[model samples]
Target: MARTRCDRTPAWAQLQLAYDNSGKAFDLRQAFAQDAGRFEAFSQSAPYVFADLSKNRIDAATDKLLFDLARQSGLQEHRDAMFAGEKINHTEGREVWHVLLRTPPESSQDGSHRSVELAKVHETLNAMLAFAESVRSDSGITDVVNIGIGGSDLGPQMAVIALDAFATTGKRLHFVSNVDGHELAATLKTVKADSTLFLIASKTFTTIETMTNARSAKAWFEAQGGTDTARHFAALTTNVAAANAFGITTTFGFWDWVGGRYSLWSAIGLPLAIAIGAQGFREFLAGAHAMDEHFRTAPLEQNLPVRLGLLDLWYRNFHGFTSRSIAPYHSALRRLPAYLQQLEMESNGKRVDAEGAALPFGTSPVLWGEPGTNGQHAYFQMLHQGTDVVPLEFVAVKKPRHALASHHTLLLANVLAQAQALMVGKVDAGGHKHFPGNRPSTFLLLDDLTPASLGALIALQEHRVFVSGSLWGINSFDQWGVELGKVLAKDVEARLGSGDTTGLDGSTAGLLARLRA
Candidate 1:
């Protein structure tokens, strides 16, 4: 599919005019008062997620123009290209086939003609799951530590923690992602070498932070008289030779089609597989696959991802909102904010379009948040009455995994009330008690936070990001921004060891000297 930047479209100009005419003064309160069916008109129900977008500053006219913008930008064709196995990740020359990882083996038989890739996907999946089950059944290994960074860490860590109720009862999962020694050190203090199984996760088995942690773990294992290297250690990487050399006889591989940000469905999810076991892991994948099908077949008007993505673009380009706050109400979903931060920021944080041309407008907004109620006390103040207008996305679960009805009811009440309060502020005689109404928020409700629901929810987020990026003309699959830091860090590390600040800038040189001293 040929790339078309959104700003270059006629719909973009029309949308701008549309915004100028009535979009700027879009009052959520007035819209509700004027339209009796405003809530039902904007709300949508998908496989496992329900979204209420009536609270957002948008209406029927805005929706039509936004859908027009999506059409003008060739979003439909672009989405088709993705599912058709074309290399939409133009720069990387790889297909964005994370969907394949989630698809069941039987799906290949349905005239999809993805049998070859599907076979490979299931091969690795079966092997990885067998290994995970074996590890889970082993009573000796009580702890599993995953050493990886970025997608390697965030996706698996977040999913495992989110689905902790389904995790192996006897085992504890630990994630070490930070390059700082403190994180790994603290994790090491909790587990002995004999009882812990270390999983090294890196596509090349050569990420500096991952390898550094891997080596430290190996050193600790050897020092503690642990000898079963092959049984105790595993690698999630394509570099078989390097993993073999590292004493990892068990290794699972994935293709370049899996970008780091979108790799949770791949072998990088081994930790998640281990935690949830093979059946639960399959359910997770099945949920994501359902969402993939929805994104593939649903009409633009009814598509959840399309609607959310269009709203994101509308807020960023027209409404001039700079950030979107995510408030997942469940404590089990605490890592969701961080997971989305990397997912959205790393995927679409681009200055240049797919054709390597500079973009005239902003792409991804600053996505930030904490779990609800906790944030209500912290940054909720700024969100409620701050000078800048920031949009909020609230994710709530209708059914609780726990039996605490009182706690769950209170939690749900707080989330609903917060959304209501954001839109309907109170006017008081005292300045401190007064609140200006008409703030915008989006509420996403799930029946439960089961593996399937969480997977669908995350897939919903991933596709929405893809929609916005595709329209914006950015390669949502590639991340060149993260490369510079690694290269510079190598130079700085050499300088640190050698005490050579000769060519260093003033601040770096001073910091190096202080560190040495």
Candidate 2:
């Protein structure tokens, strides 16, 4: 079936009418007053994650229209296309099967073309995990430094830090993504050459930033009288020849189907595997696979990912909300907002649709936030009283990993209070204290912050992004938008060296001179 852009759908007009007629006047307080079952009706439980979407400004009628819009846009067909391993990434002529990366090996042995791909995925996964196990047993290495940018850095780093409780206790994990020498310099200062392991994680092994850091790290190791480069360094790249040329024999490869942002389930998760050990890594993959199955098999209305994506559309296209705030209550999950920023924006932040036609509406929202209590201090003031109606998502764990009972109680209280404050504002006679309440927020609760729960949570977000991108008629897999800057930077860097500012705009020339000096 040909993909239909959302704006052209009949339900799009119906949704607009619904918004103009009654959806715009949705008051959360009044909705609860009118319907005592609002909480149960709006909330949903998925694999390892339960969501309370009740505080969002949506009634049953609005939800029906949103569901209608999804069907009218052929979302089901697009979703199926992805699962069947069709080339849904039209711009790249590749199938998006990051789902397969987390799928169980034996279960994926069905006699299909995708089975072959799955076998290859399992082969690389087994090799990578074996290497990880070796690293875990090695007492010589004290630190592991991952050198890569974007997906290569974010997914593994975030997962490693988030699952610190499950990590093998001896190794320290450091990530160096930026091209600035200071980042590598700071990391190098922390560990001796013999005690450090460097993992170079570029798919093609030629990403400029990653290669630069890798070269500098190798130089540092040699300068420090370290021998056996192959013993200390490994490569997670498909370009085996290049990695071999760079003295890296230990390499694991993934296919073009694996996009960087969605690659933690692949060999790009080497650091995560090494940190949490092989078994813990497998549990993480299983959690994600469970979510994938849920997304593939569950009905649209009952699907958490679908429900969240539809709500995103309702907020962005109709309610005119420009950004979404992600507040993870756990301190270990502090990097979640940054990880999601890349996942959502980089995937759907497009001006044009799959056919290269300009879109009539916004695609991705500005996804930003700090950790919970910190964000409460910094931006909660604006969230509760700001003019713009940005939706907030709060992720809370039911059980605390720490032993401090009072601290956990306070943390949970603050989380619940923030959600309540957004919906039910305090009314005071004093002018400054007069708070207008009716804001929307989503509460995502996990049983605990384990590998499985974290895996399911991340997969849920990925599928939700897929749903929105599908409805928007966008190819979320390709990231051509990030390339122009790299090309421009090369020119600017040469100009900085030569002091030739020709063909540069005034702002660029001025900035270039200032940066050079």
Candidate 3:
């Protein structure tokens, strides 16, 4: 089927009708009371993750309609086009092939998804892994600082922290993304110049914030009388000439097809690679490859990502939920919410469709949350009592790596109680104490938090975002929304120095003058 915007599909009208008739009033508590098999019907198990979607405000009939929307919207075709490397990122005129970074060397994609790139992909993969191993073995390097912004920083930082249990290299992995001098300054005080290895990550080796931090780091290295630039600094960028000019002898490069948000699986993962050993890193890739294959081969009805994406669309368009709260029950995944904020928002936060036409429906929802138990004390108050029905996603691991069984048991109990409380709330008390029942939520449980499980979870989210963007008919790979402020920043930076606010707006000009003064 040809690619079709969701609104253009016949199923779209049917969905609207369903929402008007039953969807608006569909309650999980009521649904469960009506259907004995609701949990079994709604819940599903993927490769490494099991999702209990029964608590979500969706019924079997509405789910079928959602599946119809997915089919009519040409989601399957769009997904296939991405895997085939057909320049699906039409706005940028590039293929979205970050999936290639995870594919095994022996994996046969014969006559499929541009198999010829496999040899090239593995060559870089082998080299990057070798370098990571070298870094892991180096006793002199006590700290490895990754200096990059956006995808370069968030992806690796999230993974490194998430898989902290797997990192046995006795090296501190630090990430510096902000251009704020204080952030870099604070990090500098923590590590000796000679003991630190800085990985400068920028696709072009000229990203303003990354390069700014990189230059400052270099300056500090020299200021501390540490003169060996080649030994201490490495670049994760394609601009080999620029890296060379910057006085870095070691470098790794990834393709333009790898979007910044999706580049982590590429050499952008060097920090994560160095944190976990070569074997663990490869297992990470293997885990993601397993998910990639599942996405490539699974049927629409059985596909985990498809279900999530369609449900997200339901919440955004029909149900009118404007935001989602991501509550990871594990402390180690504290960065997971921030990582997903970039992953989903940067990808689908668009005002227009792929054809440059304005879209009638909303694209991305506001996603915000902290690690659970912590969040249970914060904004979760509003979630229970507020008028707005923000959907919540609870991620919990079935097993804990730490031996604190009592703490783990308490954590698990809280996560379960939270989901249940949201769905089956108390209301017998008077108005002030009454708890409204039937708040929607999804529970994603992993058997254990390992390198492989983390890989699978991230890949699942990547594909889920893709499915939603595909149905919306937007170029999810390109982030043109992020460019406008950047361009204005350059003009404003110059004005801050010159105090020339000639054509600037009153607000900007006044603010610039005040800052300069």
Candidate 4:
């Protein structure tokens, strides 16, 4: 695979021209007042997603330039290559095909050939769902301990909590991601081994944090006289041999093409499949597949992920925005920011291109935020009155999943009002009352928080990450940066036991002493 850097084109030059001229002073209020059709012109619908981009600081010329930038950057070609199973992930020498994982069995051209892989996906999903169903129905098994980190823990944990209503299974889900033994110890105190099922989620069955936790859980289970090892312990890992060696007979596997963050559609989503059941899990895949089809077939001008990615490029490269705040209004989506933090940061947080050449331009921006009302009480002040002009992405749901009518109305109102407040601030004649009303924000409205809609939303985010990473000419799949920490941690752990300050940094020595003391 040849690694090509996206060259600045005529469209980028035109964008520079536009940015110098009228686009620099693009104001949302003035644009809205000047154009009655601003909202309709800017807002677009795709499947379960509706975007109100009129709240953003962009005009038609801005969008045209963005589209041009996309063209010049060869975004369409990159996107096409990914869908066509080309090795876009140049560093990994593999095709990025998490989308293919969610593709239904019947949708494949040859079911027999595809059956092995497709059946594995469905089989694990089915088994996990059966386990979740049994646990849900059983009054005895009240606690589920998910021992995994990063993608394994975040995706399922987030979705299970979000769709709490659909979870009539009555099992409390506990996710243990940190390597801290205290976390595992705390979880162990609440449930007995007989009542708890530990889902050890690791793609390689060798992640240090995951394996450490799994071993500790197993030790605790055995020490506590937990007899049903096969019944209580299940491994969500591709390395069946390693899992079996670890005394885990029940195991599930996913392919190399599935990145950890994108593995929820594979067996890595066992926890989610267990919590939501086979049908709901299928709906989740179908939701993502719907967005997949849309992304594959939609025009560049009308594409949601493309448009968002283009805006991301414009903000990061041209407008000089450093970070993005993701504010999901629904409490269920409280973890959306963390999920995206990994999705965007891990993918595009690279200093080098595919060929290991240092990049001249910026790649991924720092992404951070909490849920809406909570964030409003906490960091929304910084967002509104902070020194930086951080762009905010507010995700709101049109309909509520629960019957709490008043709470839903208040949530929607707060979301809408927050966007409006950001755009049209209260004017004050006094010095302290002065308000900067031109803060830009984008509102993404979903019809409901169903499994399918969640899948679509997540897939949309995945593709957007792909767009930015592709345009930046970086490999989004591989995570070489994560290794340095692991290596350093080993040295630190040894130093901690030895109390040796020799050849260690002053800060490290001090921290080690403090920890030991």
Which candidate leads the pack in lDDT?
2
Task: Let me know the TM-score candidate 3 reaches against the reference structure.
Answer: 0.98
lDDT of each: 0.92, 0.93, 0.92, 0.84
Q: Count the backbone clashes (under 3 Å) in each candidate.
A: 0, 0, 0, 0
- Predicted candidate 3 versus true structure: per-residue lDDT over 1-517, tens digit per residue: 2899999999999999999998998878888999999899988888899998899888878889999999898888888888878899898899999988898885565754467787778888899999999999999999999999999999999999999999898999899999999999999999999899999999999899999999999999999999999999999999999999999999999998999999889999999999997899899998888889888899887889999999999999998999999999999999999999999999999999999999999999999999989999999888888899999999999898888649999999999999898889887656776679789999999999998889999999999999999999998999988889989899889888999999888998899899998
In the predicted model 3, the residue pairs found to clash are none
Candidate 1 versus the native: TM-score? Answer: 0.98
With a 3 Å backbone cut-off (N, CA, C), the pairs that clash in candidate 4 are none
Report the error of model 4 at residue 112, Å.
10
Query: What's the lDDT for residue 161 in model 2?
Result: 90
Clashing pairs in 1: none
Cα-based RMSD of candidate 3 = 1.4
Off by over 4 Å in 2: 107-111
Writing each residue's lDDT as its tens digit, candidate 4 over 32-148 gives 889999999888998789998888878888898777767777778878787766777777788787887887765543545345556666666667667656766778777889999
**Lowest lDDT 10-residue stretch of candidate 2:** 105-114
Query: Which scores better on lDDT, 3 or 4?
Result: 3
Q: What's each prediction's TM-score?
A: 0.98, 0.98, 0.98, 0.95
